[model samples]
Target chain A: MTLLHTIYLIAITAEAMSGAIMGMRRGMDLFGICMLGTVTALGGGTARDILLGHYPVGWIANPEYLSFTIGAAIVTAMIARHMHHLRQIFLLVDGLGLVAFTVIGCGVGLEMEAHPSIVVLAGVITGIFGGLLRDILCNQVPLVMQRELYATVALFTGVFYVGMLWLEVNSSLATLLALGSGFLFRVLAMTFGWKLPDFQGKEIRGLD
Target chain B: MTLLHTIYLIAITAEAMSGAIMGMRRGMDLFGICMLGTVTALGGGTARDILLGHYPVGWIANPEYLSFTIGAAIVTAMIARHMHHLRQIFLLVDGLGLVAFTVIGCGVGLEMEAHPSIVVLAGVITGIFGGLLRDILCNQVPLVMQRELYATVALFTGVFYVGMLWLEVNSSLATLLALGSGFLFRVLAMTFGWKLPDFQGKEIRGLD
Candidate 1:
């Protein structure tokens, strides 16, 4: 397979795994698990297409991706007994998905002749929007709001990739460099349990 | 104010109220409450614009809208006790937002010269996406997932609006008719607790 196709496959696998992990944490039923997996797999691309004004949506156009996600969900559920230790795997997989998506998003935005600021925004959206959608579906505060440098890391990586492009770096090399940076940053953060400072909530007493 | 501007104001107010409700339900503090209100207020238009490749994003460009939403959020929070019996009011306000946004979305999509199907999709995105965003931020399964017929109703209204335009109907009349139809459907569903059938989840029992 071509490099891009290979990357897509890896991304899809990571997404499905992330979905399974999210599902297990939520104690969702098999159907809910599949729903999460599909969202994780296709949500970012769908959002990207919508933003680019690409009609019908990528997932709707390619039903196979949905089927693959569903199949992975089933496999995850069946192995739930032995998958108790999959949380670490889920975090890694989510990181991989984030890196791959950010690269592809920036590339697509550039292809569409979008402004630099908008392209960076698109990369961030493509990297994190699916996770946001998955979290929403599973009824959890998204990782973005959970005091992590999740989105900030993605944002930096996106700008890094865009800067490389502007500096005349080869596209392939730029993508590889950007993905590696994002992945390393995330892995280090996960290992060290790093987090953003919490925003002190309001002092008002009767708000709730 | 012109009728369109008046309706837009009403939509913004409705969305802010919805956001406050979501925040309160989640026990969020003032910042979270205000953020939720803004999400509810501008989310649909933002989603539609992003999807349609409309740049600068409507609310982001018109900072006044964001300020208005924040102002509404504060007002709603201050009067939380008086709005305790807010279910009926919430439903009606939500309905109005849906209708006004639907008209605005369709009008913009048409102007952008998108395909009919794409136009309708954009309209629905404008109508219902804010609530979806609010539900996601509040860590819920979004009101639509309950099979509340929310998106379907928006789709019907969008299609009807587009069809009327195709038939050379007056823009004002078309907007009014579409809004009325969507609002009526939403109100009926809310009043009668109408719902669609849930999807049958796949069984995943055996093969790990």
Candidate 2:
């Protein structure tokens, strides 16, 4: 429990920093950068809670999380010059954060007694939607929608956790298993360039 | 009430057509086109309901509305070739839809008896977010944030509605006043190229 909490905080911080990089890339103002970072850090959970009608929204209930993201964004902006050199480490943390989010989301769904399918969907939503929302707000192609096994990794984590719980596995053991497998899968996908086939359904052409 | 319902359907249809055009511009597949249309048509209401913790989300409780968006998208695709000539008509319809959505959203906020500020935010969310979500999905800069008086119109409608209610105005009368004012303002803005000044706050630059 302690480990997961720690990882979740680290994950949000890593995601916020990534958001800051995106903000700098776009030459956004400080407020814009912080806004993007906060959204990136909290978007997925917000989506999940809203979908489940979970009230008070996480950050709204816990201002500290919001503050953490804002502080992280500012710090990232300050250290923007050195970001290039930190990419590798940053990516690793991001991978861990992705796994942490998946596990946490899965837990939330399970707590709600949602159907297995809904639980899996919830996990994937929490794990990936933050980055997707961030990308959308930044006016960039959402990375998850187009490339990599990102959401797939979260799906795997969710499925495994659900299976473990169904088998009456120890709760902590199930969490660790789900987290480890998802984190490793994403890391491997990143290292080996794994990708889901792109959706290339042709769009209709305009008359003009 | 019947008028509002009729206008709501038309609003979704118009918004759906706009979504289809955006999808065509992006070269999306049938499924992608439908997804964009549905989100663009209903995104605002979903955001408003979710933010307020309104249960069941509107579309989930009303599958007919979802079907309407899907049907509209398919129809739009079929008539894509004629869209160039229909732009003006579509723009007018879109303006009307914008007003309809704002009025409906403001009504929702009033029903909830939310704080005046939150009610205004709710109305704006319901009117503007659908288009914003569509723009984000299409990987374009959201038009509302930078240019035009798009969100401003929604804001005006919300404020106007609130003022009317504060003065003990009849609910239906308040709706008409807000809808008329917002629709006219938007049409004028579109015709006259009226715009809010751009935000050009400085962005931090990287060393390298």
Clashes of each: 1, 0
Q: Give the chain B TM-score for each candidate.
A: 0.91, 0.94
Candidate 2: clashing pairs of residues: none
Candidate 1 stretches with Cα past 4 Å from truth are A1-4, A24-27, A60-63, A202-208, B1-38, B47-132, B140-208
Q: TM-scores for all candidates?
A: 0.60, 0.61
lDDT string for model 1 (A1-208, tens) is: 1564576766787688668767877888878888888888878877776766656776787788877788888887788677758667767877877877877777777876777766776787788778778877766776564456677677788999999999999988888889889889989988887765432233322221
Task: Give iRMSD, candidate 2.
Answer: 5.4
- Tens digits of per-residue lDDT, candidate 2, B1-208, equal 8887898999899888788777766665554566578889999999899888787678756657877998998887777766778777778788878878887887788788889998888989999899999888877778789888889888888899889989999988888888889899999998899998865556756578
Candidate 2's TM-score reads 0.61
The alpha-carbon deviation from the true structure for residue B71 of candidate 1, after best TM-score superposition, in angstroms, is 16
- TM of chain B vs. native, candidate 1: 0.91
In model 1, what are the clashing residue pairs, if there are any? A50-B51
